[model samples]
Structure formats: C-alpha cells, structure tokens
Target: MPNSDYSARHLSVLEGLDAVRKRPGMYIGSTDSRGLMHCLWEIIDNSVDEALAGHGNQIDIVLHADTSVEVSDRARGIPVDIEPKTGLSGVEVVFTKLHAGGKFGSGSYAASGGLHGVGASVVNALSQRLDVQVDRDGKTYAMSFRRGEPGVFDDATGISPSNPFKPFEDASVLREVGKVAKGVSGTRVRYWSDPQIFIKDAVFASEELFSRARQTAFLVPGLAIGIEDRRGQEIAKHDFKYDGGIAEFVEYLAKDAALTATWKLSGSGDFNETVPVLDESGNMVSREVSRKCDVDIAVRWGTGYDTEVKSFVNIIATPKGGTHIAGFEQSVLKVLRSQVEANARKLKAGNDKVEKEDALAGLTAVVTVRLAEPQFEGQTKEILGTPAVKNIVANVVSKALLEKFNSPKRDDKSQAALLLEKVVAEMKSRISARTHKETQRRKNALESSSLPTKLVDCRTQETAGSELFIVEGDSALGTAKLARDSEFQALLPIRGKILNVQKASVSDMLSNTECASIIQVLGAGSGRSFDLDVARYGKVILMSDADVDGAHIRTLLLTLFFRYMRPLVEAGRVFAAVPPLHRVEVINAGSKANEVIYTYSQAELEELLSKLAKAGKKYKEPIQRYKGLGEMDADQLAETTMDRSRRTLRRVRVEDAAAAEAMFELLMGNDVAPRRDFIIDSADGFERERIDA
Candidate 1:
C-alpha cells in the first residue's frame, strides 16, 4: 500500500491565474493608488515571508524609471527545477497557479500574511509585464512575461541542470565585485502595471511606500529594508532592527501630553480618597494601589472635543476593533466609576453623566493585543474578529486596575481626585448645553422655525435620499433655488467662511451667522446628541468660490463636521461641490436667439477657442471664467454643482480620526510650535506655499 499522508490530501486542485484579472478588486480591493500600492505589498509580502521563515535578512524596494516597482530580497530564491509531480518549474507554478507557494506547507512559514499563496499569482495576472530573475545554482535564470503570458524564452547562466536549486551569484554583479560565486542567493521581481487594467489611474506614491516600509522596519526587528526612487536616488534610508521589539512599539503608541512634562493639568483638589481594599490574597487589606499592567495609559486635552481610540491586533491596525477594544472601554468606564464613587462628595456637580466618551474627549489611545492566532474579518482585514481575545484582554486590564486599587504604595489618590473635578466640569457643561439645545429643537419644531432666512427650502417631495447644496453667496443661492428640483434638492447659501469650530467653543459657534444658517437648515441638532439619521438631506454639498478663500471655507466646514458630527463623515454623506471654473458663449449673425456655449475650465475654454479658430469661426461674444459660484446662471448652476447626475462631489473621510483630531488641534488651536512643525513636516505634500498665513 502507498504511504498516503496529509500533505497529499491538502493539495489545492484549482489552477491558473485567470480569476485574478477577471475580478481584480477581489484580490487587491480596487484599481487605484491604494491598489497600486497593494501590488507592491503583495511582492514585498513574499520577501517578508522569507524573513519570517528565517531565510532572509535584507530586502530592497525600488521605483524604476519606467513606472515599474522592483523588489529584491537576499533569500533562498524560488526553485527553478521541474517539480517531480507536475513536471513544472517552481517559479512557473508560483506565478501561474493560485495557492501554489510553499508558505502553505506545515513548516514553511510559521506566520505570514499570504497564507493561501495567492499573492504572487494575483500580482502576475494584473501586471502588464513582469521580469523574474533568480540567483541560484551558481547561475542566474531569468524569465519575462506580458500580462501573465510567457515571453521570449527562459535564459540561464552556466550551471549544471542536475543541481538546479544550488546557491546564488548573479554572475555580472559578482564579477563587478571582483569575487567568485560564493553561493549567496536571492530573488528579484520587477513588474509594470497594465494601463488597460489601471485605466482610471494607478500610480506609485514613493512617500506612502516609504511610510509602509518604515512600518515594516518597525514591525520586524532585526530586518533591514532599503528603498530607492526611480532615479536610484536614496530618498529614505533607514535600518530599523529593534531588539526591544513590541515594547518599543508600545512606547511609541503611548505618547501624549499627559505622559510628558507638558501636561497642562496640575491642580490642587480639596478631597482625597482613603479606601481599604482586599489584596489578591483576599484576607490582607492594603492601602497602597498601583495599576500593575504597563499599559502605559496616556491622555491629552486637545483644543477640540473629539475622541479617537485606535486598537491593534498583532501590529496590524484594527480601526474598527472588536472584543479586545470592548474590554478596554469597559475597563476605562470601571476605573472612572470607581474614582467618581470614591470622590462623589468632592465632585463639584453632575459628574455621573459624563460617560466614557466624555472622559476620552480629545483622547488618543492605542491598545495592542498579542494572541496566538488573531482572527481578522473580511478581505480588508481592518478589524479584529477574534472571540477569545476579549476575555484575555479584559482579565489582564481588570486585574491590573484592581491591583492598583489595593497597592501598598498607591499614589492614584491625587490623580483620581483631579479626574473627578474634570468629570464634574464636563457634566455641568453637558447639562446646560443639553437644556439649551433641547429648547432650541422644540422651538424649531414648533415654529416654521426661523430656518435660516437665506435658506431656500425646497419642498419635501419625498423622504427618500435627497441632497442639499450649501453654496456661497445669495446669487448662487437664488439660482440654485430656481433651478433645483425643490422637492429633492434644497439650497442653503452662506455669506462667507463659517466659524473655525476647531478653535472655537460651542458658545462661540452660535454667534457665527453662517454656521447658524447651516445648523438651522440641517434640522439635525448638533453637539453631544447629534444623530445623523435625522439630518434633512442624505448628502451635504459644500459649494464655495474657486480661489484660496473657498478652500479655507471648505477646510473649516470639514473641521466642523469632523469635530462635532464625526458619524456623519463616517457614514459617507458629506461631499464637496465641484462647479465649472469657466463658461463660454458662442454667437453668429442670424443664429438661434438662445445661442450659447459651455466650457468648464481654462483648458476647456482654450480648447474651444482653438477649435473655433481652426474652423475660421468667430464668437461675437466672449467667454467668462467664474471665480465664484455667484457668477453662474440657474441652469448652469444646476448642471455643474447642483444636479446629482452631472455634479462632482468630493466625499470627506476620517481615515485616521485620531490623527485627524490631532491635526485640527495643532493647526487651529493655540499651539504654535506643533502647528509650525506640522506645516514643515507636511510641506512637501501641501500645495499652498503659505498654508498658515
């Protein structure tokens, strides 16, 4: 009888690279800059697998002049010999067959991102041309492909066919170094993205690539990765090999104002807590308390009132966390409740209502969990879906807090006392604000409600998903009011830039006429208890001028929504209005009485004139470039920035809410140094020369 084993039973029967190209989005998410980066990541993942296998130490990523990404690694190159079972080369099987790589084996790689072995094949199917060069067997074997099809033929250096997968030495480079082949081996892959597949647009972003490279540099200690641009010019060259590993990651993630001397809150509270708690022994009582877990808790009071809590599962960011995140939140609430109950008499007033979110206002947290096998949900893998991780994390944190409460050397008595004061302050504000906001809501609901005098409310044709265009100036407002399908499209016009809510308090915001107009029109109440579903329009379009001030106003509006109504931003209902920058009118003698022309921008205007000039035509009337939305007529306004079918809208995204909140505090708050440093750091990306000014 044949010795049959699990390896034979587990082999994948499916074949070919056709599925990837047919449904590329399934493999790489989408064909955009993000997807383009994903292609590089897939190849880099192969090298990372090698490192994880303890085979390679060095990896290099380069952007070639021809707009192709190249990744090289000093690892055991893919086997070039024919497989005994299928009579196919290892490199060919890897590139052409799905789930064909060795990482799927029991002992190939203990942990890897590409467990199913679909990375290389998927990349191959989506690429225009791929060049694979392997340094092995004292020879260099090279193969080329166009859109996953073999091209030209295979070329190889001098090496015996019997010993195919020997060692390395790309002969020319070895000769250049004046050394004989020393059996050092590796693999290199270069690929160009297919323009047909990337028709919309997919291009390499060197900076974002470097950022990811730096992430890998930090993730895997003792691993070196070097990145170079198309010009072979070293842009960012860093070797991150940290022996301290995750402890370093923890330290980096725990940075906040409270962790440093820059802590703004250092107050003298009147009350103190003296509670005797049983120790872990249960019999012995201790006055001392200490949070045993080195969770490195840090908090900062930003200029704005927003919360961003980021959690990670095994170094991978879980923006939308699961069980572990829930435990952390529960632990925080537990600590807050303990402190509040202990100092209930000392708390000024109304401290109970300020919940976890209140305590975490302008807060940034990083919760990292180390698990055996983290279960991630979905293809994007942005969330931790593990079931047992919850209990593990919760137990660790709860015990630590309990120990802290029973510590013999407890000093949290002072910290907890001050926190009670802060909670009370927030409580007072919440109560007053809630009352005031409720009264306004009732008044608005009772009366025709002084809905912004300038706001031209279109009839509610249907409660279906409709939109409202908040354009700048009364002229655009009037035009949009006339042209919009009143039932489905509402129009609200603002006088100028709305208040920068990032630097202003809720009270300060009420004074801004423009902001008030928006608030009144939205119908959905703002501040603490804002519900996005109650928003009058399914979408909000910010229509403004085409110049710098318009941009500033747009930023301000974005900031307001992000700081106050973040859920609205997350729901993807917010969008920017895109209107044409120019309009052209054509005229001829005895032509139609309603004769006119249309152009969108300077380029379009120039092109129209060039076409007319080529036809020896002359326009009796000239064209006009609209600097502001007020310049457009009702029909033009509806066609360009109002009509859902023709209009262009840019949706706002809180990709990193924590970073977004930090940005607002730094840019719009009273901190000058942080703002200056931010501008300097992002100078390369920021288009404006005088961003702050």
Candidate 2:
C-alpha cells in the first residue's frame, strides 16, 4: 500500500527562518497572546542585557495603534560594520541568522539572559514586519524586513557612498536615517506580530507589559524603564526606576504586612573548578577554571501566613526554582534551626528546633545571583541547573545570616529577637498540630474500611494499576458502574458541588462528607500527615459532565486536592478524563449501512461531516450533543471515556506553584471582586458557541 520510490529525494530541509515559522511553538511557547508577549520579551531582554552589561540605563517601550510594539534603549547600538564571517552587516546578520549575536562566546557581555542568541532572529521569524534603527558614531542607520525577509525602502533616496555599510541586492544597506547628536548611542526595534501565526485578534495587554517593565527596573538598579500605550484613545504612561533593587522589591511586597524584621545581604566570590582543555598534542588535559559569582538577598518576615520567595539567575525569574533556590532554602533553614536552639537555651525553653515550613512561614525574600555562563534547564529558563552555584549561594547566605544573627545589636528587644520569637512560636504550634494529626490519622486508618456507602470499590488489590474516577452525579455514577472494569476501576459519586477548599480551613474541609469520602478513598493522609506512599490509586481521575456546572464541580474538587493532598498533584498522579460531547450517526442507502461517529468538539464534528461529504456519504440531521455524562449509555461511555486503549486523559501538573496558588485563591476564595475581574479578563477571548449552557 506504500510507494516504493520513497528515498533520499523525499527528505526535506527547512532553511533560514522557515523552520521557525513551521514550528513556532517550539521557539515562543504558543501562538497565543502569551507568545506575542514573548516576542516583546525577546526585544526587551536585549535591552536589559545591555543594562546588565553596564552600558544602558534608560529603556522606553511603546504600544502602537496597529498592535505593534517598539522598544528603544540607550545602550551601545548594534554594530553596523560588516561581519567578517558572514560578509553581512552586523544588524543584518543578527536579525537573519539564528544564534548570531554577541552573547555567545563573546567577551562583549560577561553575563546575559539571551545566551542562545536566538531571541532577535526568532522574533523576526514570527513577526509580519520589523524595523530596526541604530544610533552609533554620530549617524542613524535603519533597516526593514517583511515576513523575516530583508526589504528595501520604497523610496531609495539619499543613497550615498558616505554610509559606512554596503548595500545588498536591491536592498540599500544600512541606509542612513538621520544624523544623531554627538556621543548619543542606542538601538530601537519595532515589530508587528503576523496575524496568521497567532490566535485571532491577538493584542498585547498593557497591564502585563507594565508589570514586566516594573519588575525589570526593580531587578536592575538605577535603570529607568518607561512604558507608553498609544493603542487606547488616552495614551497611558508609566515609569519605573529603583535605586534599592531587590531590597525595594521586598519592601514593596511586604508593604501591607506587619513586618517584624527586614534586612539585606550581599556577597561576591570566585571558585576554581576543573575543566578539560585541548593541549598541543591534540589530547585533553585537566585545568583549573575560575568562576566568579555574586549573590544578593533581601528578606522581610511578617505576621501573615503567606510565603513569597522569588529566585532569579542573572535577572531571569526562576519561578519553578532549581539548585539556587534549594541552596537558599537549605541555608536559611540551617541558620534558623541553629538560632532557635541558641535562643531556647538562653531562655531555658523547651529543646525543639524550628521546621522548614515554620522558618519560611510569613517570609518574603528575593534571591538574586549573577554569574558568568549560567546553565539553565530550558529555553524559557524558569530554572537554573548549575551545580556549583548552589554551594556558592549556600556558603554566602550562611555566613551573612550568621553574622547578622550574632551581631551585638541582636539583643532581646531587637528586631532579631522578635523574628526568632515568632519562628519559635510557629514551630511550637506546628509540632502540636502534627501530634494531633498523627493521632487522628491512626484512628482514621482503623476506620478506613468504612468508605462512603456510595463508593463502588474495585476488585483489584494492586494499588499501582488501580484508578479511581470521581464522577459528578449519581446518574453518571450509575453508568460508570455498569461500564467500568470491576478489576481496576473504582467510582465515587458526589452530589452537586462540594465545598471550595480555597476558602475553607483544614478542619472545616475534613468535616464535609463529600471531601472526607474522597480523601479516605485515596489512602494518602490529608494535609500535613499526607504521604504519597499510601496513595491507593495510580490515577485519581476527575470525570464530570462537559458543561459549565461540571466545570465548577471539577474546580471545587481540584481546590480540595490542591489544599489538602497537594503532594498527589505534585507527584503527577491527578488526571482529568475528557468525554465526548457530540455523536454523529452516518447513514447510507442500504439497511445495514448505519455508522456512528463520536466527536469531542464542534470543530471535530464539522471536520468529520466534511470528510463524509467528500466521500459522497450522507449523514442524518440533528447531531446529538451530550450535555452531561448521564446522557451517554454505558457502552458508549466505556468506549469513549473509560477504555484504557482509546480514552483521552489529561495529566494535571503544577508548573508554577505561586501562580497556581494565587489563581486558586482568586477563583475559589471568598473574595468576589478578584473573581469578577478574572472572569471579565478571561471572557475577552472566550467563544459563546463553546458553552453548553
């Protein structure tokens, strides 16, 4: 059934920017507003890199009416001279070639965020049109591109040989745009995202951009970042410049909280590391390499329960955290434990050490590390993977913390004493709570067999292969019970909506019968006593109706898990089962020519109908749309949702705990204003046709 002529001739290679356009998600994450913001980030990162290199101090960003963005920075402008390697102007090479910037292996920047050198080129590849202007050597040079291809100005006037750059085919080289004032130098970039590459009517959110600009300003001291929105009728402008850097950031985050103590610490050091080097004999030899690094940390402890610890590697936020955060946390915990023991001895208090959670509670800290040649985990650089930086940060933080704690000013009435007292109180409370939970857990274990009467337990004893489906209603549960394989699949039915754990305390949540049943079914103890080893099911799948009500129920259940059994979510054991929403019956002329087709979405239904039409097949009118899982028969439900071989399941993961926690609080918390605002913001791009009710 295949062609025998399939050979080397069929192999295809994408050249230049074509590869980027083909797989844009690989470069910028996705073809949505987020990716569009990423394009802006790439350009802004270049400007920030300039600032980090001690060349730029001012950056201006503008959003145009046409949904385009322009970023200008008073940095050393991009070189205009011809690059010897490519025989092209520096500006042209940087925009057209991948991995062709000064950051890679160049001494121009000792440390930078855009280390892969693909930022500019990737942005160019995804943009519909881009214009670049450089102010260098008392002259302004400009270049333009369309769809990642270089283009010439329509009016090629004032073309003179006095320009330093040479011209390309039909393209006037870096055409001199204007004469800059003496000693003024910088680069300005303007780009418009291609409509075809992004979601429909994609537009940048001004608030998001402003927040990012403010963050950059705080991260880089003395750098002024300004934003102007010309897209709206009234031009909005904001400027951010911070002299205290991360210390100011900490103060800002803790402004509303009742802070007990606040302090900043910083240190720099160089360590010798072994590396392989090539010798004259073409053999590898071991040599010592010196790596320099700087660590700056600011902390503010308050009376609130929230903990905000933001970590960065050379100004790039590591929200997921990595070795650097691990080092910082370990060092803080070590110092706090030592100090608590000392304080307890001095006061003749009970001999008990503070737990990690107690030390981190009510804490707001910013950990920043600047180093040469940092190793990041991924392209987006949400994590730092360098092993040596961890040890270096730990050492620096330990010394600094010890010095601050042992200082003569740390008397009983000092801020240091106040913080230590708070930590010790928290530790005592946590220990008491843990003891109570352990006692309760033992009692609950003995009564675990008294599972909710509604739960239909599976026959299998193999926990690793067993799955528990938390169905929405009794109607759906009835169908699931008839369809599920009794050997490995169990079903638990809940009525209506359960309590929203985001707004409920642990004691309040454990009192709810629905929440209690689900927790007991998953043998993992709830809250602080939770242990992943005791989990009864390999997959705790949330199966609900494909409607708005079902979505609310699912959210309530997720909140319960996220707050009580978070380790289950963190271990990737949670899943969501997607049930088909539409079923189409294809019919032919004969008596035995009826066929059934199931579609998950409206788009898929349309595509299926179109394919049937192309094949000259006829289908009946009035396609059946499933409003709830109860609408599907047991056999159909089994084939579409529960079958291990054909069903679709989405594994839930917590990519950013801080963001996830914030969203959960906003959506499920008692606050209604934030939820209303969130709904309004999300409804901007939502489609009404997708709603079932």
Candidate 3:
C-alpha cells in the first residue's frame, strides 16, 4: 500500500548547520556524555595542532563554575583579517561556517591532528554559547556566538581610528578591547554545551580529562599542558610536560611489570611515486612526486600475559589501529621469529618456531607517525589509511631490530638474547600444555567417550543455528530439557555454582570436573589457545533462576568465561537468558475464565494489576511469583524463557577493557575491605519491596 501523494517535492534540504543539529550522532557519534567529551576534544585539538606545528609550547585548560570550559594557548592567534572568498572575518567564519579553517589548502600547517577543519564549527553548532578572543599585532579582539550565530555587542567602544572597515558589520564581528604590550600573541576559547541536545547534563569528568591531557603531552614532546578545575570550593590543578615522548609513556606503562629491556627506534624517509600533471598542452603527464614521513617506536616486554599496543598519526590516537598497526605487528613477528630460531640453533635446542601471539605476549609498545598529508579512515580518525605508511614503518622497524639482534660483536648474554630466551620458554610451555590436553582427550575417549555424559545433545549439526544452554541445578535442567527445541537447542546441567576461576590458575581451573566438562562441551580450547572458529555453539547462553542465588551462580560462570575462555565472550557469543519473575491472573466481571499476564519486573506487575482494577475485572487473591525456574512446567517454561521468538537475552560485551578489569578485581578479588565498602554504598539504592525473599 504505497502512498500516492509522495513526490520529489516532499524531499527537504537542510542548509548550513541544520544538518549537524538534525543528525548529531553522524558527526560526534552519540548524544550521550561521550559526545560531550568529544565536543571538548574538538576544542582542545586546535590548541594541540598549534603545539604540533611548533608555534606554541604551553596549553592551559580551565573547567569553570557554570559547566563551561576555557582553553587557552600561547600560539599564533587565529587570523583576524577578512577572508576574500567569504567576505567575513577569519574568526567569525571559522566558528559559523563548516569546513572553514586553515588546515585544508592554506599550506599554513604541514602536519596537524585537526585535519578536517570542522572542529570549531561543529563545536559551535552544538554549544549553547561560545566566545573567542585573539591577541595579535598589539591589540586584543573579542567576538561571541549564540548557537552558531554571531552576536552583536550592545555598546561598542574603543575603535581604532586607522581601521579600514567597521567592527561588527561586513568585516569582523570582533571589536578591539585592550592593547597588547610587546610580544603577547595567542587564542582563547570558552564554550558551554546545549542541554537540550545531550542525554544528560554535560558534566565533564576530571580524571578522564586529565588522562587525555597527559597523553597529549606525552605524544608531543617539549609541550607543557596544564588543567585547572575551579568548579568546586577547592581548586585542583595539574601540569604535564614530557620530553622523552612515547618512550617515557612505554616505560610508565611497564613500571609495574617485570621488564627485560626497553628499546626505541626512529627514522624518516621520502616516498617517491608518480602523479598526474597537466602541462600547457592540456595533456595529463606522469610526474614524479615525493612525500616525507617520520616514524618513532618504543617497545618493552614484561612478565605478564597482556599485550598493550597504542598507535597514533600526527599526535592523534588511533585506537582501532589500521594499516600502521598491521605493519608493526608483521615487522615484530618477522624479527622475533628469526631471532628465536637463530638462538635455538646456537643452543642446540629442538626445532620449534614461535607464533605471533607468543612473541607479542607481555609486550608494551607505542607506534607513532607524522607525515605531510595523512589520509584517515573517517572523520573521527580512529585509523590511519595511508598505503605508503605501512611499508615505511615496517622497513624502518625491521632494519633496526636486525641490527640490534644480529650484530657480529653482540654478547651471548645481552638483552636481545634474554628476550629471545623468554619467548622460547613461552613457546615450549604452550606446546607442552596442548600436547597434555590432547593426551588426556585420547585417554578419556579410550576409556569411554570424550563428551560429557550430562550434556543433552542437539540434533542439528550446523553450528550457526545451534545453541547451548548451561542450566543450574537438576530441577531447572529437567524443565529446560523438556521445553527446549531438541532440533537446535541443547542443555547442560551443572551441579551447583562452578569454580571461581578468578583466583585459580589455568591448570587448577582445568582440573575441576565442572569447569572441565563445560570447556570440553564448548570445544574452543582455553586461555591463550582459545579460538572462536572452533566453538561448538553459535550462542552460549547461561540460564538461571530469577533469585539471589541464581545471580551468584551466574557471576561465577561469567568469571570462568572471562578468565579462561575470554575469546568466546570477546566474539559476542555469550548471552544471559532473562526469565519472567511474576504472573498475574485476571477474570472477567461475570465470566469464570481467567486471563494470564506475565511480567518481568515488579513495576510491570503493579501496572497490570492497576489496569485490571480500572477495567472492573475480578482477579485471584494472590499472584503467582516464580522463585526459581524449577517452578515452571514445560509449556510455561517454553512460553516464558526457552522459546527463541519470545525470550529476552542480554548480550555480554566489554566496552572498556580498563574499567572492566578494575570492576572484576574489586568484586571478585580477595580484598574484603573494598567489597564491603562497595556493598554498603550500593545498599541505599536497593529496593526491599522488589526482593521476593
């Protein structure tokens, strides 16, 4: 049933900054607190760009009392003259118009993080009010904006007699305020976010902002960055200035770990390629062109198992890691694998090659590149997409590693040899563990069967369509087995809460019967050997009762998956099945028939009862509440929790690795004081009316 009135006339056009307001997520990613942080980042990036171009050395950030922010830099201020094409002042144009900055084609900046030149305009559009002040040519100029529109001053004064144009009309929106002494030049920006556009009030987190400021100082050497929070009664301030750059960052990250050695490599080169050129004849001619690149790398290996690698382009963090990361990984793998093999030959060890994972384990490294023109993958710039950067970085790193490790006069007990030995030991340990697991599997098969006997297998052989439900207690298992669709759903019943693997080693975890059975059923291996491709089920769901004990059991199982079978959780294959907690029965005014309504929460139950009361429908005396899954019959269980079409499943994911790790440690570790304090703080929010017990 298509509408007959639809035509081309219905299409609407969004002009100027309206498109950004209509679709804020497309520009800043989201309208949550994260988007507010991105807005602050946009303003800070301009100051950072000035530092990168060697124009400034100091950046100061202030969090004001009115939820506004101010960023000041000791760099060349933004242009105060009129732009010929737009016929508007440079400062006014930069804040009001999109894609109007010095980065695009001005050639005023060779390498910079603010590549798109849309930061200032985007921030202005999303802000409620913004102000800009520039000090240049021994005079201070000021201008203001409200929601991306230039503001007019009520009483303007102190105009320069020699000035050619008016202060506020067609020339610059700025008016001269004060005279600068001799050599003071810079730009200052102050902005407040629009409350209507953000989900929550745009409140900045001090710790997160401080971390970013420190990281910027580390990325750009010889730059001083300071942060001041003046929103509270007691003002707090911190300063960061790092001259050692990324090398110091690596050392800081590896301070707590047992490091073998720390090394750094840096190089620069020209990328010569062919380009199209049009001569006087109007024919395209092939001409040789060259682009310059600078690369710096720092690496340190520790005794832990986590690998931390951060990459950047022109002082901008690239968390998603594109071609540059791939090149670095490849170069490290090649160099380490060769070094390990050579050492093995000299020591007369068996023929064993180190895998990429083993070589990179316990490694902390930072990769940075600066080029004349960097091509990023997107506006957010989470990845570097330049093709030549990959080869250049790989070549520089490989040559440096070879010279360091394969030198003729190198000592046998040098730092390189020590690192090689550690990597070899890791390789042998992994091989031995795999061999032992295979042997145990063979022995178990010879005795009877390798599969766990308690598992109720599914009929489908296709892994993509199959699901595995790990049920708690035999009572609930019986109901789930009867209710499940045997064609694609399988059930495995555990005795009780499984072992808490957070405090246990890998060997100890695998030795537990309950943990071992679940691992064998998953078929994805464990720990470092875990692979998503070998998983037996597409969705591994944990089904438990809707009670306190059920929550404890679920937590224990999650701990196991997070510690030993992390790849399964990381691949988005883990889920939690939520069952309804209450059931309401309503009867018509004169009829004996009853209408049943299932509610997942107490609020929903109250609403349902209220609606029935208003409809004048009589109901039973007491509603039936489910304490455990064992209370439901096969049909009831299928309708409430087991049916794929009707069931509600929550997918588990790790959005922030650092936060997740800290949370896990606080809740699962053996520290009693922190756990007690956390419970006490959270108890105030707990509603006793909702707890069935």
Q: Best by TM-score, which number?
A: 3
Instruction: Give the alpha carbon lDDT tens digit for every residue of 1-693 in model 2.
Output: 022312222112115577888888888878888888888988998999999989989999999876778999999999999987667789988888887777754357777776367889888878777889999999999997655666553435532212222223443377898998999999999887887799995679777888778878889999999998998889999999999899889877752234455677788778777766556675878877788889999988875445789888888788899988998899999998888887786644487767788788778999999877677787777889888888888998899888878788644247677677767766664664454444333222235554567889887767788899999998999899989999899999999999876765444566688987887777566655577876778889999999889989988999888877888999899999999989898896767868888898888888998999899988778988899999999999999999999899999899987688777877877768978988999997998987863
**Greater-TM-score candidate between 2 and 3:** 3
lDDT of 1: 0.63
Cα RMSD of predicted structure 2? 13.0
Off by over 4 Å in 1: 1-14, 49-58, 74-94, 100-105, 133-186, 221-225, 231-256, 259-304, 348-356, 370-374, 400-432, 442-693
Candidate that beats the other on TM-score, 1 or 2, i.e. the better one: 2
Model 3: residue 198 alpha-carbon error in angstroms: 3.3
Q: Compute the lDDT for candidate 3.
A: 0.78
Candidate 3 per-residue lDDT, tens place, 507-556, comes to 45767899988888877677677667767788999998888888889999
Range of the 10 consecutive residues with the lowest summed lDDT in candidate 2: 5-14
Models sorted by TM-score, best on top:
3, 2, 1
**Total clashes, candidate 1?**
6
**Local distance difference test values of all predictions, in order:** 0.63, 0.80, 0.78
The Cα error of candidate 3 at residue 307, in Å, is 0.6
Per-residue CA lDDT of model 1 for 1-693, tens digit only, reads 011311221123112555677678877878898888877887997887688667888999878766777899989888888766555667767776776767543336544565247788778878867778887776677765555654332236522112222111121112111222668778899888877677556678877776667656556667788887755454445444555444444344432233111111111112122335445554545453221111222233333344556565444456788877887777666766676666677674533455775565544455665432345776655677755555556665666555544546545544444445555555554554454445434232246454556666665534356777778777767777767887677777777778878667555675677776676567565666566656767888888777778888888888778766778888888998777776655555575664456565555677888998998767755456677777778888878777778777888877887687677767776557988988788888875633311
Query: Candidate 3 clashing pairs?
Result: none
Better of 2 and 3 by lDDT: 2
Q: How far out, in Å, is residue 410 in model 3?
A: 6.7
